[model samples]
Target: MLRLRLVTWDVKDTLLRLREPVGLSYAAEARSHGVQLQPEALSRAFRAAYAAQSRRFPNYGRAEGLSSRQWWLEVAMETFRLSGVREDAVLALMAENLYRDYCNAHSWELLPGASETLSCCRRRGLRMGVVSNFDNRLESILLRCGLRHHFHFVLTSEAAGVAKPDPEIFRTALRLGGALPEQAAHVGDDYSRDYRAAREAGMHSFLLHGHGRSAGPEVPPGHVLPTLSHLLALIEKG
Candidate 1:
């Protein structure tokens, strides 16, 4: 039997989802600064920019040595090129809106059975933690959602100084959780960053689907499950 030591989870798009459309809050806040933006249009632009930035990080890390936050800010700034918004102003708006949304308990909704699956892992005596490619505010988000108590450790890319698809972030999580790479597992929705990187780091990895409408690569995950609750059966079988 495989010795299960730690169970690491991803944050955004995995455990919790945004309660409202992206930039709805931002647009509201931006209106105060004399910037006119419709919620839906701003939301679409922000999401497109976010996804594009995420895709560029691995490449930028491999080449220009850019940090995740830096990458994101660049993308965010570029997204406002047509709006005639100043760089400093755009960044301030983003920071304010992101923190406001994350810290607001009503702005985040937990995934179906996320709490139950985590409780099952705890009951099984498996050390549980979170490893996510996110900014510093992830801790506040977890606390706001009452999930801070569930994880033994929380490693954000900003804290780790590296992002996913890079081995250092996963290695740091293993060290923090006191688990050998082989004894740990990572579960997330992104196939390339979460599953592929965890597998490359010698951890068992599972891919979660059905959260959003994004079309992912055709490659299969080591274990495929539609919801977090299904992970319990996979661990039991193993």
Candidate 2:
């Protein structure tokens, strides 16, 4: 039997997703302030700018690093510029509003069945925590979504000073969970960061699939689940 003592999770796309497309949120907010933008265009531009930021400051809220607010302010401004809202003052107002919107829990929704699966894990007496590349706002998000109480701890890239695939975060999570790597399992949607990286860190890993998109730089998964409920089955059967 595959016995384990701890199980950690990834936040975005694993436990929760944005209530609306990030670009759409920016576009709508900007529209309310008299700045017109195409949501699709804003989304594309946001993705590009955010991707650049991710590459540049993957863990921006950590020590001596730019805050998440700063990083997203840059992304929001880039998104505004790309979507034809180039006025400096309007861009600043939109960026500030967008950043504030994301900080609140209202911006996210729980993934289908996430709560049930987590209840099952807790019922089985597993120590759980969150291992995510998200900024510190993750705590508020999880708390507002009613998922925080189920975890023993929550760790984010902001606090860890590194994102997934950098074994340090996983190691730190393991320490917090009081489990050794071999006795832990990680669940996430990203194939590289959640599955392969966890496996590489010497922990078992599960990939949340069937969400209509797959993360890149493929790798062999320890397990693939179409829904969160499937995870409880796999663990119990093991």
Which structure among the candidates has the greatest TM-score?
A: 2
Cα deviation in Å at residue 72, candidate 2? Answer: 1.3
The residue-by-residue lDDT of candidate 1 on 126-237, one tens digit each, is 9999999777778888998988888999998777777888978999999999999999999998888898899999998888887563425553442877788889887766
Model 2 — which ten-residue stretch has the worst lDDT?
213-222
Model 2, TM vs. native = 0.93
Instruction: Give the alpha-carbon lDDT of every model.
Output: 0.77, 0.84
Model 1 / residue 209 / CA error / Å:
1.1
User: Tens-digit lDDT track for model 2 on 16-71?
Assistant: 88999877898799879876778888789988888887777667735546787787
Q: What is the lDDT of residue 155 in candidate 1?
A: 90
Evaluate residue 1 in candidate 1 and report its C-alpha lDDT on the 0 to 100 scale. Answer: 48
Instruction: Predict model 1's lDDT versus the native.
Output: 0.77
What are the TM-scores, per candidate, against the unseen true structure? 0.80, 0.93
